[model samples]
Target: MKRIALGVQYDGAPWNGYQKQLDRHTVQDQLEIALARFARVDVATTCAGRTDTGVHALEQVVHFDTELTRDTQSWVRGVNTFLPDSIAVRWASEVAQAPAHDPHLEFHARFSARARTYHYVLYNHPVRSPLLAGKAGWTFRPLDVERMRAGAAHLIGQHDFTAFRSSQCQAKSPVKDMQSIRIERSGDAIVFTLRANAFLHHMVRNLVGSLIYVGNGRQRPEWIGELLRARDRHEAAPTFMPDGLYLAKIDYDPKWGLPQEAGSLLPWFSL
Candidate 1:
């Protein structure tokens, strides 16, 4: 059997979430169905991370084991022909599929991931833009980017992120290495870029909400440090909307040779 890794991009508004469900109304369900039609057989898939409903992905990495042989381009064009316009296979790569006992060499999509980067786009204007509807988080209050940046700095290391975790999260631990958090603003658009080893459910949204409070002067920058030490979910701000969140990238070892792209958090804006 051969393991095929696929780079996927999706709008995420039409589907319930990334994972399959009994109702079969999800990104995974749609992708698997398209794979079945293209290959003329059932194809189960595993993703690097399962995004929540309405959360988009610029490039989501997924993998599946198949005995059927096909060229990489065939997997991209062939599967995409059966997929919806909102979802498309951007690229494909075949990786080493080693035995279960020797997992170090095997390239499991989720397990092999080295880090993840998420981008949260916010529209800070009194009047919302029709063009950004369903694409960005909106706040009528003015936000100070510098304050947000100061608040974000408090979360830039390995720590227990229980304050930012959702109650529904099933992560094994709340401790994660928060590599960096960069906040920038261009015109009315504010973007928060976070890179980490991994994230807890709703962690990014919650962090953004808390940072928004800081940006709006509702909370002091030092409050972020207090929240971290408190480790209580109720102490933090509410979870921000998933509409603005994008799983921008799932980083892996360079040896894998996945054809991924690099760009600003928002394609148009530069930090």
Candidate 2:
């Protein structure tokens, strides 16, 4: 068997998310179907994380085991040929050994990644943007970027992120290490950048929603710190729309023994 890694990018608006569903189109379903067509066998994939519906990805990672003896270049072309226009396999390579026990076996990847980065787009303008409606979260209220940045600072560390996670989250624990969270405004758009070891469901969206409240003066900047201490979901803001979010990147340590350029072929956020 040959174990191969794939770097993918997709417009999430057309599908149900990364995981396959019985009757819905999905990133994973498309990839697996394409792989089965190319290799002529049913194949399963393991992804770095599961994105919600309408949430895009610039660099999503996955691995699969196949019996095919094709070159890396063929894997990329062949997969793309079978996939819809919304999905693309940016790169592929054979791995010496598969990352360890599959997540499906026990809900954990074999290796630990260094970090994952997510970006959220908020359109702050009086008029709605027809071109960006499904790609960004739109709000007409003016936001105080300085206040949002101040509120974001309180989220930079390991803590119980229960307040920022959705009740539907299936993680074993609410504790997560948030390396950094920053809020920046460019013109009429607001961007939320977050880097973490891992995330629970709707964590970034909920965090952004809470910060938006601070930016609008609806809540104090220090309230984020208090919410963290409280560790209760009701103390946080509502979950923002998934359309504004994107999985920007995933990082793995060099000691993992993968190629140095393993991540280079993946796409990045354009804005």
Candidate 3:
């Protein structure tokens, strides 16, 4: 059996999340159903990341083993035929696999990932836009981008992110390498881009909410550093809505040759 990697994009509004559930009302359930229909066999898939409900993904890498021999494009177009309008397989490629006796070296969709990138788009206008209701998060208060930047700066580098982690997070550890955090505002829309080696549950949302507090002058920028040092979840801001969060990209080594699209927040908060 050969391992095939697929690049998938989906709007998470219609599904519970990326992982499959017994209720069969998730992105993974839908994708697996489509895959079985296309390949005429049950196909199990593993994803690079598991996004929360209502969190979109620009590119989610998945790998599955199959004995069927088909070209990459066929997998994309064929599986898409059975998928809903919210999800589509953008690209597919055959990847190397290690022997079954030593599977640790295989090109795993989740294990082989080097980094993850997430974007949060927020509308800072008094009145909410119906056009972007579920597409973005809305806040009535005016946000200071510079203040938010200063607050975000404190989160850079490897640190124990317990203050930002969710109680339900299943991650083995709270220590993570926060590579970068970029905050930009285009008109009334503010975009926050964050990259890390990995993230705990609700980590991005929690961080964004705290930064919003700093932006609105509710909390001082220095408060973020205190929160980090304290490592107390209760001292941090409440978790922000998942509507604005997007799994923008998953970084992997070049050997996999997966066709990944560039990350962007266009037509809304382009910067």
Candidate 1, residue 14: Cα displacement in angstroms equals 1.1
Query: What value of lDDT does candidate 1 attain over all alpha carbons?
Result: 0.93
Off by over 4 Å in 3: 99-104, 265-267
Better of 2 and 3 by TM-score: 3
Per residue, candidate 3 scores C-alpha lDDT tens digits across 164-256 of 999999999999999999998889989999999999999999999999999999999999999999999999999999888999899999987
Tens digits of lDDT, candidate 2, 113-151 = 568889898889989989887788988889999999999
RMSD to native for every prediction?
1.2, 3.5, 1.2
The local distance difference test score of each candidate is 0.93, 0.82, 0.93
Candidate 2 ranges with C-alpha deviation above 4 Å: 98-110, 255-271
Report, for all candidates in order, the number of backbone clashes.
Answer: 0, 0, 0
Pairs with backbone N, CA or C atoms under 3 Å apart (clashes), candidate 3: none
Task: List the candidate 1 regions with Cα displacement exceeding 4 Å.
Answer: 99-101, 263-265, 268-271
Question: Candidate 3 has what TM-score?
Answer: 0.97
TM-score of each: 0.97, 0.90, 0.97
